[model samples]
Target chain A: IPPPMRPIPCKPLFFDLAGNHISYPMDEIEEKAGTSKKSPKKEGGGITGLVKGLWGWGGK
Target chain B: MTTPTAAQQKKEQEKQALYVELQKFCQSQDDTRAIKVASKILHLFPNDEVAFKTKIVCHVNRGMFAEALSLINDTSKLSGSVQYEKAYCLYRLQRMEEAKSVLDSWQSNSFKKVELMYQIHYRLDNFESAYDSLSDLLKTSDDEMDDERRTNLSAIAASLKLAGSSRRVKDIQ
Candidate 1:
């Protein structure tokens, strides 16, 4: 009997996500709750906190 | 008996505050903090669905499969997605039989469930079931992941046609 040829590799999933690791669909839980990537509305927030968080203005 | 209205409102407000914190932790991808906040929410409101889910997902992201599985078992009447989580935890724990059992009870033919089924079967060396799952994925897959799915399908078919698995490539095809 002839030997069967080895198969090629499949495309990678998730591409090295830090926490999720693989394409585990972990975010589906948040998405269904209408909460994925969206922060709860904070009161009286303008641009100060955003800038500080973005560039570490005060911490650095 | 009903509680006083003001107290009830205060409790509601408290729950909202914890839930909002949980949401913030999730947004930041601070999974450990998310788990802690979610545990707080669940302690306060045991029936909070999103809190339960958030905690479970955090456990998984941290590779705490055993913890996630224990929590899933202790809870009652899990949602379909949560049931999938249970199966996933079992699979990650390398308990293939229990994982397959959980998946066998799954009613919906969701893409996630099918993909997981394929993985579990593959891990158990059940190539036939894996082949069938890949076929199902091929039939229902969107363009977003069709290429990967096809590659997996061909790989499974090729391996099965060999002496390792009894099923022929033509049989799976």
Candidate 2:
């Protein structure tokens, strides 16, 4: 006859931490990664682009 | 066409056109447009009774009964038929005192006056009063009434009889 199957018990390897999956001090990590969050600046373009920019500013 | 004076002919044409516009507005339920057009007509011919009458009708259609009463207040200048029509509007607006006062001032020998009084009484739910008044008028004009007026009087009399019998039976039980 075949042997009866045995049950297996294992300890949990991972724990659910605090509020979200991400930890605090993310900006410190970003600095270590050599990345900056500043947006690119632009000079004046054509009249159409200027008008579009004015419209965008108006919408805001 | 040729015999009438130019001014008279022009005034007739204007009245005809105004009447057409009034009819159109009435059928289309365009009370605001009717008031504007009637106002313009009155401006052109200040003493035009028909235009003023049309204005009252427009006001009445728009549920502006107060305006209609104010416009129709110049009873001395208005034709008898116009005053009668104004009284009808007052009756519809449930202004029984105003309607009664106007009808009292009117001479009631004519069929129009009798009809107006009958309408007032009928609207007030005073069927017996209407019957009495109509009977008095019909009694006075039995020999002289034309066919249409006589027929109307007869119909009212029949209605009064029916109402009277039903009312008497109800009272008896």
Docking class of 1: incorrect
lDDT of 2 by residue, B50-127 (tens): 566667666765668677777777544764535665666676678987887887887655566666676577556576
TM-score of the second chain in each model? Answer: 0.86, 0.56
**Once superposed on the true structure, which residue ranges of model 1 sit more than 4 Å away at CA?**
A1-60, B1-3, B77-81, B164-173
Candidate 1 accuracy as lDDT: 0.67
lDDT of 2 at B91: 69
How well does candidate 2 reproduce the true complex, by DockQ?
Answer: 0.00
The DockQ figures for the candidates are 0.07, 0.00
Candidate 1 C-alpha lDDT tens digits along B1-173: 45698888777667666755766677678889988877887787788777787788888878898998888888875444488788888888889899899989988676677788887776776778888877877776666656666666666666566526766564323
Candidate number with greatest TM-score: 1
